[model samples]
Target: MLVSLIFKRTYRPNVNTIQWNKTIQNHQSNGNYQQALKLFQLGIEKNTFQPNSVTYLTILDICKELKSLPTVRKIHHLIDESKNLNNDDIQNNPRIRSLLMDVYIKCQDIDSAYKIFQSMNERNLIDYCAIMTGFNHQKQYEKTFELSKQIPASIKYSSPVLCTLILQACIELNKYDDGYKIHQYGKKFLPNNKIFMNELLNFYLKFHQEKQALDIFDKYQNQQTIIDYSLLMKYYNRQYQPDKTIELCYRLKNHSHIQIDHIIYVLVLQAIANGCCLHTSEQIYNQIKKSQTHMDINNALINMYGKLGNLDQAEKIFNSMSKHNIVSYNILLNLYGLYYQSDKALKTYHQMCQHGHQPDDKTYVLLLHTLSQTPNKINDVKRIFSTIEEHKRGPMVTAAMIAALIRAQLFDEVNDLLKKLPKENILFYAMKANSNETNEKFHYPISITNEQLALYDLLMSNIYTYAGLHDRLTNVDEILYENKILKDRLSYSWFERSNGKIEYFKSEQLQLKTCEHTEKLALINALDEQKNSSSPILIGKNHRTCTECHDYFKKVSLSSSQKKVYLRDSTRFHIFSNGTCSCEISS
Candidate 1:
């Protein structure tokens, strides 16, 4: 009797169209989308009730949620069949067609979505948004721009959604001029809208217009979010304004409403690392330890300690981590390389392999770098270079190998390797080597930027001066002047004092009087600022310290002041005291 009752309930008939639609709507409202879809299909198959426009719309909504492309297509076919019977007309129902386009886009069938969009005789704002957003998501930035041109001017200026989409396209296409105009439009029209305001902030940040970004941030203080603060902090860090980054972090920390997260902590740590303030870094580290524990934060801590020349602390953090990933191992390997610990780096590489982590291209490059530091490890460098797959040897890997060979004074092998590389790669190598011979011999098909040409000229001049080729150096200087590239890419250095004040000096600023190198100017300024303090002065440079600068630092270490100095360059740290440098081989 129970089985019979269940069968009767399952096969109950006489359900009208209104009852079927209500049941589907009920299931949909309750978030039972699959059940809603099944009921609709059962109602259609059983012919208990005729499916109406409402039923079709609800089913399409379900398909959109499920991302069910096959089911959507089947329903579209049924709609077409119904049109033939004059029951439902798709042409008259733009709402249904727009929904259909949205479903197709959500299903990842952009071609079908575009077809439906094209079939719309009178497209609304919704239609344009659905299609353009789809194009943008698919990375068809050009198509998005083309559609923007067709947007009716009446709605184009008023729709925040359209403005945001166009701004995103402008960013991807690098259309700075258009992006600026859009920023002005957003300011004039949609100033108070949070969505558009956030996008505008992003636009300014992308173009590196810090003043403009700050203006927007200030104007939208009430609407500001953690993401905005994070983005601004990241921008400052990228621009090497670590002090500004830390200052902003302090502001965010003091905000009474918003709470800091792990990402913000990582950015704060990164800023401290760049600033090279061991005290501030330690303070932040202690605060982080008391509050939370995250892998990214720990990794960033390791990097911070590494930059401050505290390898033992970096190692302690690494040992404390319960799990390790490729990034963790890479950071440790990089730290070892930075300190020229080739043996330890090699042991760590073996351990990484044993733990089933395959070494990537960066691993091989780091290994080569560490091995190149010691003259006796030339053979190890060659062995490691051979193990790297040919396809994986990109421009950076090849350049690293060439650098290693040059450091070992293997000029013949360097020349042979240069011969085997493609012309483009050879040009890249020439730029790094600053070889005038290579520049004059090969005519590359690619056109390098003016900035790159200026850098090439500067490095070549340096090479000429080092070799005592006065005539060649003079000729390069003439070219540099003719190109008006003076001081465009000149190096600068800065140091933080004990009282947390930062002193910056540019190489160009001191060219007229006392110092020619950035590090020298920075050192003089640091000594003047911290005359009473005998602690080691840590200075960070934007470029590598030349041999002249290195020797000068060594001499300064033995002078009357007897000041110990730590100068961090593009690659590693150089600690000078008592007329000795930490680097085994001077540049």
Candidate 2:
């Protein structure tokens, strides 16, 4: 009777098997994928019972979830050893192969995925798409192209994913002609599919076909994805159309189906900041405050306020932050340096150190620049230059330091530093500094310094002699006034302008009998050329403008129908209009 009962029973899973399967299912359902995999590994190691096909399938799912190649390989080995499991089973079930292929591809094991793909007897559209995607992911462009060409026309045309992959390949290779042809062929598949449509739009943008790009965007902007909006904002920002960028930002904000993200806000903030529209910037700031609190948003606001020249507001934002990063301090340090607030810049640097932020190369560079402007901070400049040399910074910092020294009129130190500088043209001939030294060797090498130095010498001599002065009221002016004859003979006779034409007016042209100022010569030439138009004439004087040119511009402004004259003298900018100069009261 017992034998009869045993013979009557069918092969059913025992209690252990039922418990193991339930545990895996429970963990997987709960999204505890790693625990699911670990329990499966433990069940196999126990060898309590033989795993059925369903068990192997569950293991494959876990491997795919983990995207682990080693575990997939272990499962593949176990399946090969099992008598019940074989390639025939895999061949019969394409899903197992697809799962394995997905795991391999996700692990960036393109070769293994390709082998699995090729082993399939009857390949489908998905298999072809998966392999092509693998190649694309690996940036194996040639392999992708070769595989794409081999796909059947019928299969390729029906699969939008395949078509999109081919388009991406063409885009990556910068094959504009081929991409355009393929895009026109696949236009029918792009209506409802945002992924492929964006690829098509990207192709047009890559080739700089703005009209075509905009046309494509307008056709599909209603159905575009978040990525599509981001790309469009980037394009507009690149084109310097801040208004369009902000418009798109507002549009994205109002989209019912789309959720605005922090990344989009960061990009839009850059656009509005550059527009200098502080009103729009304030609105965005309020939005960011409501929904987001990130270091990036804070940094962008700091940059925007700095650009608008509101350092107090920038500092307020900086102080409001509970946390600070290197970039945050960098922004404030650069702001102080840009405005030439040496004390504030130095204080910011010390504060950054106190906050445990290590200074980078840019920090040191900004400090060097600030120190250069503060002539009284010469000792700090020396210390910073030492740090720069210790870190083996490049020639730019060294060059800047040398230039700072020269501007400070520390010519002896400049000569010593120039010898240490690398053999660049600007640094090479900087050893020569004295203008009164008669030795040709001590003079700047004309070949390397080029004609700019020649022009500089001519301008300097003009100011040194005060050749345009109406009266020698001061004794120092009297001695220089007496030395004009030899200086005038040695100075430049003519100079050139941007029009490729030379204006030849010797010192004889000066209303002053002794000499003509170089800046006066250039101004007279510029005004005479553009006498008919009532536009401001810009003149750059390398040295301080002589009293004669100052008086001349005032007279020119009043007499020439209010023709403004802007003079950028050595120290500051002076605007002359209607017989009045900006520096009139200060002088």
lDDT of 2 at 265: 85
Off by over 4 Å in 1: 1-51, 68-82, 89-92, 188-191, 353-361, 376-389, 409-490, 509-515, 558-564, 585-587
lDDT tens string, model 2, 1-587?
22232233333454677678778888888889899887876666555444556666777777767887877777766654453333344335677777778778887889988998888777789888888899998998777777777778788767678888888888788878877877777888867887888888777776668788778777876787888877778777664455677788888888898898877887787776544454466677788878868888888788777654466898999999999998898878766654567788888888998989988766765676666666788788887677654447655556566656655667788777666666643333333332344323322222322122322332233333333433222222222234343233322323223342334433443233332466677777878876786645655443345677778878887887567666654333466778887655332
Which candidate tops TM-score? 1
Clashes of 1: 0
lDDT of 2: 0.65
Residue 322, model 1, lDDT: 91
Q: Model 2, 349: alpha-carbon shift in Å?
A: 6.0
Runs in model 2 lying further than 4 Å from the true structure: 1-23, 32-35, 67-69, 80-87, 90-93, 118-122, 131-146, 250-261, 278-294, 324-330, 341-587
